[model samples]
Target chain A: MKSKIVSKEIHLKKRPAGFVTEDDFELVEVEIPEPKREGEFSVRNIWMSVDPWMRIYMVKGSRIMPPVELNKALSGGCIGQVIESKSDNFKVGECVKANFGWREYWAAHDADSSAKNITKVDPKIAPLEYFLGLLGITGITAYVGLFKIGELREGQDTVFVSSAAGGVGSVACQIAKIKGCHVVGSCGSDEKVRWLLDELKVDYAFNYRKLGESNISSELKRACPDGIDLYFDNVGGKHLEAAIDNMNIFGRIVLCGTTSQYNDNNNTSTTSGNVNDPSTPTLSSGPSNLSLAVSHRLRLQGFIWSDHNDILNEFNASMSKWINEGRIKWKESIFEGLENAPKAFVSLFKGESLGRMLVKLGPYTATSL
Target chain B: MKSKIVSKEIHLKKRPAGFVTEDDFELVEVEIPEPKREGEFSVRNIWMSVDPWMRIYMVKGSRIMPPVELNKALSGGCIGQVIESKSDNFKVGECVKANFGWREYWAAHDADSSAKNITKVDPKIAPLEYFLGLLGITGITAYVGLFKIGELREGQDTVFVSSAAGGVGSVACQIAKIKGCHVVGSCGSDEKVRWLLDELKVDYAFNYRKLGESNISSELKRACPDGIDLYFDNVGGKHLEAAIDNMNIFGRIVLCGTTSQYNDNNNTSTTSGNVNDPSTPTLSSGPSNLSLAVSHRLRLQGFIWSDHNDILNEFNASMSKWINEGRIKWKESIFEGLENAPKAFVSLFKGESLGRMLVKLGPYTATSL
Candidate 1:
């Protein structure tokens, strides 16, 4: 018998309760089965994203995406090279991006009909990983959120962005600055604050973690003295409450992520186990003065990137020019090995990773058959 | 000297703690003063409105309208006959609408500038008090919040209105039904529920008080099996939370009122006096499921009718046609005398009055010189 190829993969072993740890996942090595049918291909994964949204997927009944099956290989956005193909659409050695993540290799039909999720990438346009960050979902998210949802106007709106040093926030900060709006950003660390203020040229950046024991509301008030006209929220909890309090009349809030609330829930079934005791269930943080939303004539809306796919062409045209002119900048926190992917994801919650965090399965090279 | 005209007025005696009571207001007989300007007119007030928004106005430093001054006549929307006029714009015997409220009689300069707040009424078009309920700010509020803010589409949206028996709510229910939407309404009493279902012909109407201790979410879900697309919120707290939980993707919530939370605060200041304990503050009830707003792409917006004066002419045209066609119907909970005005206002919080609550100062008469 011919020797079989083996692929390393990560699987969800247990559901995370509160904070995620390595124990929640398991690493396994499985035989890389050859394509059993015509029009199939085998791909060697190289780069994968570790995003905050993945935590949302872990919940059993998340409205956004399906949950990660227990004891199954985790699935997410991945970029890889096809090593073998039996289809006319995908030739061997072609690089493509798809939703087959947290694994070393994948084998599936590469027929155009079955490859609805796959897209061919151009490396000469930018580095392969930059496609995952500045040119792909992350960048498009910032564009749609800031300009489309927040209705940010050049010189007219004053914007406040939470998680300012993260992938979407960094791009949002730059976009607002480019639009000539006064931008204020809040991050967990001083270094991230410096990156936003000094590198991104954000009008104001503050370390929300070190707010000197004062309430986030007071800190935000000081930072946005004139009051915020637009708010792009990533870390929900206190950030949302403070935004509601400080928003100007007819302000708009683009709800992106609730990173703080994800791990705080006790379990997949978000309700507190004791039904009689309302206090025990982990209630997500909300604005105590939500009534202000009415008084201030504020608009708070939640949005996901998929709903705005129609803007892709316009986003690409503007972003490509901005990138070529160096008007846009991005940073990455790369974990070298696939084995460290779980750790990379956990660091997001800990506020250790800066910008977009990704796991590199292997080095980039010309596609080889 | 001519005997001075005695005007009985209602004044704020004490700021309400939770539920407004008779103690919060005092009736005072004051000598009516003549308008000092040459263009001023004296009028005998006939009818005035009592609305849910008055609760919001009672809070100190209310951002909506200026707070009613202590020991001074409370001001609100009022209709009266111009007993005297000194200007071309307003003539004696021309019934007009003005903001001089909570008093029996007033003397004012009717110079075009001084009379800017007053508008001559044409009773030949509709009954005079209908202006206060169906044609005035109340009806205009329903028109703006539904079509303008909530963006209600005929046959496309599923709408839920809280306090659906009140002025704005009753109008909103009829408007949504007229627009060809699936309308579900919640009121405090079975009688109000019957009126909404039997009289207004709403698709669903339920007495929220009879929900049998099952959370509002359960009751709402049962009523709106297809999920709610638009929520015209008149009662905040549990209503908001239930609405958030049941809202569909791209749903819109018109944050109109928070009557439920009006009395939850411990005192008039609203701050829990216990400085050492943080939880004691009378925090207005807010949606704990607010994070769902981000997940479902929901838009919760607060709006005031004043912000949308641009729609007045259109509103008058459409609403007049609707009323003339008998496509719109309204009911009034009338307090016979100005002395009963405070009770009328308090009845709103008590859920005692159905439809638009109004204080009838005197019989409608043709303007007389």
Candidate 2:
């Protein structure tokens, strides 16, 4: 049979306000184009990763991470089956993880195929979608950020993670636990607090909602009395200030993402005005109390996981070992169709769902050996 | 023959004003108390070191260094002698360096003498007072703070030293000069500016007075076209803000002292009707642009020379060699009598004098060298 083709894409509809609405995203269908280039390949996207960082990417440019242009299909990591291939490097019908996004069927360009090595996906050790979450960008981000940026030492240290129940924080907490450090995490709700404490095995967890900005510090002090030695920051506003006060001498603050600050389509904003009065001094959330770096001799730094991709195989082996030993565990808040991927990405910023948010595509429905 | 003992001291009498008065100081005489215990020896202060840091130390609750107590003799580092001792560890007339300050004589207590070490003073290379300035705590502070904390590499970098004529900055410029990096120094007067550019061999030197607060940053930029890599801060506050603006990526700001902000002793209360001036917030002269540390990836740090004292011998040798080779030279604004030291200390906060301000003690008559 001639290779079947279809166009599936997640598109932004309207800009969001405070919280993202369903109108913000539109799922579209069109004709799929065939690849004419020698290195090009076509794959039906089976699994699409929905992440908090996707929220930042969705917004055009209000932050360090630039936002996606309006109307562009939001790109993320995807596991897909090769339906057709012009490149001999990828065989037909083999499952592989590609750096293509919220799409049903797509032709990856030569650069995308090279940069994101088209590797076969395995379902035996865990679900194939685990390649997008526990073994994907989130996993590598957690590993490198903890070890390299945070200088996470084993035993007799304190670890504080913001967005503790989220994908990256969950992995960081588990790693800190494995390294024998006291890990305290801050999440959005009581349910996440419960997951962090019971399931994820974080030393301590707190619902950030219950504590007001003024009191968040005292409550954090109660949770991690040992003091924070390594702070893996995903949310970077008042949480950063409290973390600084709680930090021990020579602490390392790793800048992963500021998910708490990004709002839907327009992400990059240098200044924010007070609600009551515009003349009142504006609020900018990302950088807070930098003088803390001087007093306590703290090292605050920002980095991307892609910068340290050299440690990929080691990260995979270690994470797999922990999963088999039951030392690490994670959950996916998965959406049924590829069309819902944009909604899942929006929900990440709105605090609507828990865990590694994702969308499932077709071609992985068959029962595996 | 018995060693003659003349215990001389300079005591704090009254609190200071914009300038320290005779009433602010009291000269006293006391018998040199014999050190009682083993490992304890008497140190007759030979060459007492008075520094810009000493002025900040004279005030209460400075964020940089500890405050000097009222009614007590001021204490800092000095080249001294073990004239008489009961301890087996000590011999008579051994030259040593101690963190023993402005007093003419100090009987070593076990605790105060802990940082004290036996090292012969070398006069031929520089001067006997060089132990109190260039090859002393000040030099070590500049070396470690510039090289280690600041991470100042050789080329493709610029340095801006505030209070460039002060002890630390005076030496730092030469060091940066030696490293083949561009160095700009900020000092008080036209004379000091000439001295800095001519004698210190800094690439650029500007009188901060001529380029006052309003024109601070622009003036600094004119001096350092490449912006700043390493900022050895001695005169903190508004100058600090200018330095921040000129800081390049991954820049390091070492907070050696904030001489400008140490004038709390001189902030005379005005009977301006309402203390709560909601109309205008009272912004101090210190670095108001502290937030710049984030986007610029600047490291603002304060460290005591005592932390890296191990490098003292190494710095001493190099500094001595440099002085002998006529490769480095700096002015010492010596206050003639012990009484003038208080005036000199107060002048630091007022920005009146230039260069390393020192109180010439009776024992430190340089002619003996």
Candidate 3:
């Protein structure tokens, strides 16, 4: 077997300002590092997932978690093969998942031993890449946020999902549908809207950019006349305010991410515009109508995906079953080659990617076969 | 027994603006009708409790719960004896608590029987007026807000009670004290603060009028450097904002009342004081720093005293037991007679009364010997 000394890696160049740019990352190459003295493990990267929360980490002064350091390769869950192993945790030629990312290859000292098993894609069920997308952290995020924080009760309410056609939104729509709830999603494009309503079978989907805030709020009200009972919030700002305004009594708002307010350097404004603004009526600040929460008896909670680790096993079990039943389907906007990873990460903020934006690190190896 | 006759009351007079003066009230001395035919009862007022929520009722156009209609007599709770009864739920000579108020006596047909309760105050334990104040709705409001919404876990965290020496505050301080939690209270006078610390055993007590918002927040923070774990909010405007700023992570804010904003006619400002002033300093109208609820993983829930029945039972049982044990004491700023009820009610806004504010409607003619 030809061992490709893969070392093409993407490293953090600078913390991003609001929207991330090419300057925010550095793509570098190096010879695969020599193995450690004793118990070390080597792996080859095959796939890496690009997530919206990564944008939050790129900010100058982040509130959720901490700001990513400048000049270090950012990391996340990546699928790879155990090429060489000296630890009890791994054996040669085994494929696994670990949170070491944006690199062509890695060698971990004292492998965690608990790296999840993932080799070949079950074509009869879902594509191999689906394991890294909706069926993975993205899918589990939607599941936990909706089920645990939102506390969705079947047939009892409507769910307002911001960024409704993105990875988590798509899966959340399906989960909500299974729970027999009315699902209304807000995304950036007509295609997302179509895919959401037609394929994901969300009850309603609207292009947030095209619709004004008032119209958006009213459209949500019109779509879910009974009023939103659960808000699975991904993109904050206006979406949050709209959800708060149209929430039913005892509604729950899950604050997962705020993609809209990610541009850090500008510091021009961080507002979810208010309707009461006489001059600039449209850009109401997100928390403008929050007092409505007290009257409506609303519950708004923020959550980190890591906090819900216990639900992962249950989520994997249920989501895998859904995949097998052909009830859940996912697609990825794939960027081939390690060099294009930065472009994919930046494209996330601009809504350039069609689905779960991902980077294919290399061709699948024959270890599993 | 000379049965008190049914009386008429003037409803909402001119909607009071700012301070409610005598001009804002219209007293129409109307005739008392004979006892109704069926499922009816008449109650002669014995004692009545005035509350800050009554200020909410007097607001011109409240965005939360609807304001009382103009020219309608404001309604609240009172303790009374059944002078005449035709209902299966009530009998003559029994004293009960009720929401039916304003008039000296009442004749109800098919009244809310579930809401009516006949609990004879233990004369050996406390005064009969105690049945209207600390042992009544004021007591329950404090109990539920602090115990239920605030989730006061004893010795686990500190509690900050706004209006700490008032009806609810007085009891809340005592309860938190009994539960072994450090308690900080905000009242309007030095005497009230002295009483809260000296008499009610509040760990720290400050007169809000004597200190700025920063001083109040920092004082609480200085007193409980771990930061306030539970904020039992009574005054909503600046105090709410200040308490929110000083809250610890996962803090609980019980939105019991927003009395400061209640007298404003509308919380919406002619200036509306930039709703976002506290939270988003850059934005002009962004909602106040209340979004700390989401940022700090805080849980804030506002509730009216819905369980006027259950929480009251829990509160009274707990309170009586604590009082008998000498673990708690209270102050009562008793107004002399029914004629002084209006002055006492107005004095609530002025912070003139200390401890449990009560209007001794009449001598308890039927107190059991």
Candidate 4:
């Protein structure tokens, strides 16, 4: 590895008003510092992840996580190989997953503070990119959301997943089917709908954009005639209202993401506005029929992936078994280079990504795997 | 007991278009028939209970329970004595609780069909009216909602109860306090607020009517500075929005009742309208800030008392202990005669009752105790 590697990174240029744009981020070149402290190592990034949740962190005062500081490098899930090591814990050429994404290279001490954020990856388990998608937090989120949060009963629950062609939704749909459930999914495009039906083997898939927002409930009714037993919500707003309408008695709603509301700039600005200002516009109104939660005995729960770390071992075992049996499959929409990461992220809200949206920064050099 | 008694009962005259009125009910007089069949008995009603949930049954297509038939006698919780019995199970002069309210007298065979609906009541337990208020379904609802649904943690949680001066709400406030939780309650009147703070021993109580709907969220923040951990929601709409605003991470919201939306006639009529009609007014828009459920990892669950029959024994044992320890207290706003039952039921929405509302019909004649 070069003693001083010139790495390009994306930094937050400005906060988005409503919908994020390419200009909100700037690609800048910087010097990758050396591992000077004891138990420190440097890594060359192989693959980086771009998710809808990143948009949430872009805004200040977001309750989920801290906002991305102005002019600072944006961070996310990344798979990288250790090139320089000064610690006994991490060895050279070992691939690891860390939160030092949106950059080509990163150096960090393997101390208690940063050690928890980094994990060694087995390249032989699948592929290097799979660590940033299927075998990573993305897959763990789908598994935990369905089994732990949604409590999807095998062969019994009629599961409906929104954003079914996306990373988490695609995996959740396949997992539900593998558990013998009747799966229904809704996506933005006919191409994505076909992918959901043919590739993912979902029992039913619909192009929500073609159906129009007003007909979401009716579309859901058509898809799940028996009523949805469990709903994995990735797109909130009309999708949430529709799910509430089609929910069976005692149905569960796992609140994963509100991709629809993410770009609704009105919700974001109003949330940061004067809460005491009576004139402040109502931040995106929730499902109108939420009271149905009572009449129908429904349970809607939201969860962060980090909160369920205890279930990682259990998730890994089941996920590995499914992968070995060829029961689980995933798709990635990769954008080459670090500069294209911003464009890839902006395309997410446009419903352009077929599955996991990732950016390729470098290549895997672990030939032994 | 008279062979044939002239009994007065309230019948559903016309379902109200909006909030219920006195004209919606009609007082009708009829001759009570003799208990001639085997295992049959007749009784003079002593007390009848009026509840907000009765309004839900008045609608044509309520999902919770069967709608009340027009021109038929309205049924609810009542305490009566067996004046005549030809059965081995029930004895004459024995007091029993049954769903034969809204009438001065009732006669039914103690067959399997009706036997399941009636239960022997010990007048020695407390006052006969207590059977309709503190020791009846009202108290049980509060217990189940707090412990089973809200998962009220003793001495740990910060609890908030909406409509905290009403039957279920008042009981819930006390139970939370008894469990050593920091409790806050919201009622419609200053008088009720005083009752919540002084008698129920809640940490804080606010008059929501005085605070106004716009200030509900601020009021909640003021009352629960540390944020609400568990919310016992009786009044939905603004209170729900406020609860969502002040909820801490991983908070639990028990959807006990939507007394606010129940009276919003638009919700009821639109719910019954054409499923395909886009112009059909949205049945009461839920809390506008419900997406906070995702960022905050909140859980909102709705429940019906009938579904939890298995927890009855545990509830009874705990409730009895609380009553014996003098930790449980209740208040009732009583209306005289069956004709006044309509007024009592209507007053619930008006917040005229400080606690449980009941209609007194006859007197307790079981003097053996």
lDDT of 4: 0.78
For A1-369, candidate 4 gives per-residue lDDT tens digits of 546878899999998777789999999999988887788888999999887657766876355556789898998889999988898878889988998899999988888525458998888778788888788877888899998899989989999988777777888999999999999988767887788888889999988768887898998888889999999887666788889989999999998744423433334532221111111112356777766787788999988677898899998888888888898877778899998999988876664446677889988885553
lDDT of 3 by residue, B28-88 (tens): 5555554668878777877776665565566645655577777655576677777777876
Best by DockQ: 4
Name the runs in model 1 displaced over 4 angstroms. Answer: A1-7, A13-42, A56-61, A83-94, A107-115, A212-214, A258-283, A346-350, A367-369, B1-40, B55-59, B107-116, B212-214, B257-283, B346-350, B367-369
CAPRI category for model 3: acceptable
Pick by TM-score: which candidate is best?
4
TM-score of each: 0.86, 0.80, 0.84, 0.91
RMSD vs true structure, all candidates: 5.8, 6.4, 5.5, 5.4
**Deviation from native of the Cα of residue B251 in model 3, angstroms:** 3.4
DockQ computed for model 4 against the true two-chain complex using alpha carbons: 0.50
The ten-residue window of minimal lDDT in model 3 chain A covers A272-281
Order of quality (lDDT): 4, 1, 3, 2
lDDT of 3 at B26: 60
Fnat for each predicted structure, in order: 0.62, 0.06, 0.28, 0.63
**What C-alpha lDDT does candidate 3 achieve relative to the native structure?**
0.66
Better model by DockQ, 1 or 2? Answer: 1
The lowest-lDDT stretch of 10 consecutive residues in candidate 3 chain B is: B274-283
Candidate 1 CA-lDDT value: 0.75
Q: What range of 10 consecutive residues in model 1 chain A has the weakest lDDT sum? A: A272-281
Which of the two candidates, 1 or 4, achieves a greater TM-score against the reference? 4
